[model samples]
Target: MHHSLFLMGAPGGGGNSSVLLIYLGLMFVVFYFFMIRPQSQKAKKQKAFMSNLQKGDKVVTIAGIHGTIYKINDDNATMQLEVSPGSYLKIEKSALSMEWTMAQQKAAEPTK
Candidate 1:
């Protein structure tokens, strides 16, 4: 009886162990697709947007200052923003907000 109980508690059941491992792997895959994958795609898009910034593009700073790109320094990863006539501030490239692409497109439309 003791031997049977010991066998029951022993880690020798390959069948059950394999099932548990398969379940864990499936769970990890599900979590990755539903949670991790989308976040990584968003990060990739944001990084591309940040790297493609250019002069004359209107942008808002992370600090909520709206301005146009006056200068771009690819070497230093910085931007000079023109907030107003004769008013400019140097800011890190990462501090820029999403590109105002929609507003620019609307402005470029021919008046009917």
Candidate 2:
């Protein structure tokens, strides 16, 4: 009985519970700021990019296929990509890689 009491902490002091609550709150805040916020912001950007897509916009897919947006099917969330002259492929909007597409666009730009 005495050993259990020692393990459980002081019966009269409530400081430990308060401190634990504070620590958990701090951890939640840290996780939100460092992980959740950035991810949601990135998702918003990706959604906006996908929504703003139009025909003739060149893009790179997550699968590394480079093509131009030939047609957008809003109802099914798919698009037809022109991979080459007279060559086309159907793909999902979500398959587009924002990072690779940005990089490809940057490479296509003329450097000053």
Candidate 3:
């Protein structure tokens, strides 16, 4: 009976159980907005960029090989990259780094 009375009196000291629950809920909301949402958006944008890749696009591989897309074997999920005139390398389409390639392209552009 004493233990039961102590447990009942614990809620009277201004600490509410729902306060912890609300804090946990608020943390999830913050995590989803700051972490999950941006990561998902970046993935969607990367997928779109990869799908729209075509011949003659200059790209940088995740391994940092800079080259032009000479051919796209969509059925086989591979591409032929021409690192130099008449030289080529067949690789997976997923090996391309969207962020790195875009940065390289931006650097290559001449200022107006």
lDDT of 3 by residue, 1-112 (tens): 7855544445575445656667799999999999999999999999899889999999999999999999998674899999999999999998999999999989999999
The 0-to-1 C-alpha lDDT of every candidate, in the order given, reads 0.78, 0.90, 0.89
lDDT of 2: 0.90
Determine the backbone clash count of candidate 1.
Answer: 0
lDDT of 1 at 104: 55
Model 3, runs deviating above 4 Å: 1-15
Candidate 2: where are CA atoms >4 Å away?
1-11, 74-76
Off by over 4 Å in 1: 1-14, 74-76, 99-112
What residue pairs clash in candidate 3, if any at all? none
Q: What CA RMSD would candidate 2 show?
A: 4.1
The better-scoring model by TM-score among 1 and 3 is 3
